[model samples]
Target: MKKLNISVIALAISLVFSTGVMAQGMSKKDYKADKEKIATEYKSAKAGCASLSGNANDICVAEAKGKEKVANAELEASYKPTRKTHYQARVAKAEADYTVANERCDDLAGNAKDVCVKEAKAAKTTAKADAKAQMKTSDANATANEKSTAARSEAKTEAADARKDAATDKLNAGYAVAKEKCDTLAGTAKDNCLNQAKRDFGK
Candidate 1:
């Protein structure tokens, strides 16, 4: 009787351990699958943007593709999944702002084009600000907990935002100058000139 009782106890313990291992394995597999799906979606979104044409279309497509890239990168990031989630949400909001600004650009001409570019610039600025805010929050949390890895991640995020902001500022400034020149022209020539400027400036 004693032997049988001991055998049963050993079998139960083995079963429980096996179940736990299987559960962990499943969780990892699920995470891997989710990451792949996000990447696939991002690729498809970018490809869809390629179909658009014209200045507004160009802006729309570029903004769409940019967001897609950001989304894919966030998915590939090594930080905790929760942090990735927060970053993606902020990126999405920024992308939405870009879309709205692009649409507003459609009605604009000359100085109005400059204004539209400024609107897009403002959207980008806000996005960078949001990213910085998130980084600060992450930094504070990491510092409080003394997590070197999290602090490093936050620093990297902030650096990326800074670089992006700098590039965008340069582009917008150039666009403003070009749009001013376009404003000096008149009629269809001005429209064509503005379109060319938008294309050349990658606006």
Candidate 2:
């Protein structure tokens, strides 16, 4: 159990590093090379497992396959650079750990082995749930950010429109006052004053 726990922790750490290539923007050539490397590593690991026997060999083989699965998932995640891809990587790690843990259970017997298998399954379930929750939270945060930016843009537009309205209202009021003053003038002078108000206020 202790060894399994350590393996789980180590897997988590390795997975975190495995996807670092995503930030670098991996190309098709690099991705292909990485896949080939992973396959070679898997073959080597399997060959190493041949030295073991019975349940031990089974456990070793399971671990080798699990690591390969995780490597592929991580490589895909790195190439895609999407939330769903990263979540897939996390799921892969969970499945890999669970497989290794399940195979190890073969070494035990009766209720103890059953318990171990159950614990492994539970661990896998929890990992998947956590990954899902993280993905949802990231999606929610992205939505919130978009909404916040939209709200700010709308506020700016509204403020600009309000300023234009205020300016128009002020000009209209000034024109009215100018026209009332023109009422005191007579004939041509009155006409000229109203013309000036009209021109000044753009009426």
Candidate 3:
């Protein structure tokens, strides 16, 4: 689990670097060569997964596939550098993490499994919400750069709204995870757990 966490972190950091470097634009030749390199790396990763068995193998394969998908998405963003591509790249990373997490949850049973899945989903929701909010904020800021004082004020308002919406989304997802945990309890315990979740999340 620790290893996977570290690997995911490393991949995420690489993605951040790729975004900054790739956004500057790349030659067609360089883009094509990078795509080939990504493909080679993916093949190597998948091959490494083949040595494992059962759920472990499944997890390994999922990680390999997730990395490939994320890499491709990042490459596209680097080549295009559009707001849409950047958003897609972020979504890809979120989904990749969720997939691997859900796969890892297969090692558990009962309420624990359920909680694991819920937590993974909550993480995905939080990531996606943040990504969307970032895109919106970026758009607003860019527009603000080209407009008058009123437009700047409007941009600020839009950015604020975007962040508020993201916070709400993350809060809702947290509540869901908390509620899922509550299912493990009975009667009054469950009721108290749910109430706490609602209060904590402002739900």
Best by lDDT: 3
* Model 2 per-residue lDDT tens digits across residues 1-203: 32333244234423422343444478899888788878887898899999899989998898788888888888888788788988898899988887877877777665556545656665676677667666655665555557887765665555555455545555655565567557667999999999998999898
Tens-digit lDDT track of model 3 for 8-102: 32234234323333545887887887788778877988899888999999989888888878888988888898898999999999998888888
Candidate 1 lDDT, tens digit per residue, 47-142? 776677665566555555555444444433323345555566456555655554555466566555565555565555556565655655565565
Ranking by TM-score: 3, 2, 1
Clashes (backbone N, CA, C under 3 Å), per candidate, total 0, 0, 0
Q: How accurate is candidate 2 locally (lDDT)?
A: 0.70
Each model's TM-score, in the order given?
0.42, 0.64, 0.88
lDDT (Cα atoms) of all candidates against the true structure: 0.54, 0.70, 0.81
Candidate 3: clashing residue pairs, number: 0
Candidate 1 regions exceeding 4 Å error are 1-28, 46-52, 56-60, 73-79, 82-107, 141-203
Q: In lDDT terms, how accurate is model 1? A: 0.54
lDDT of 3: 0.81
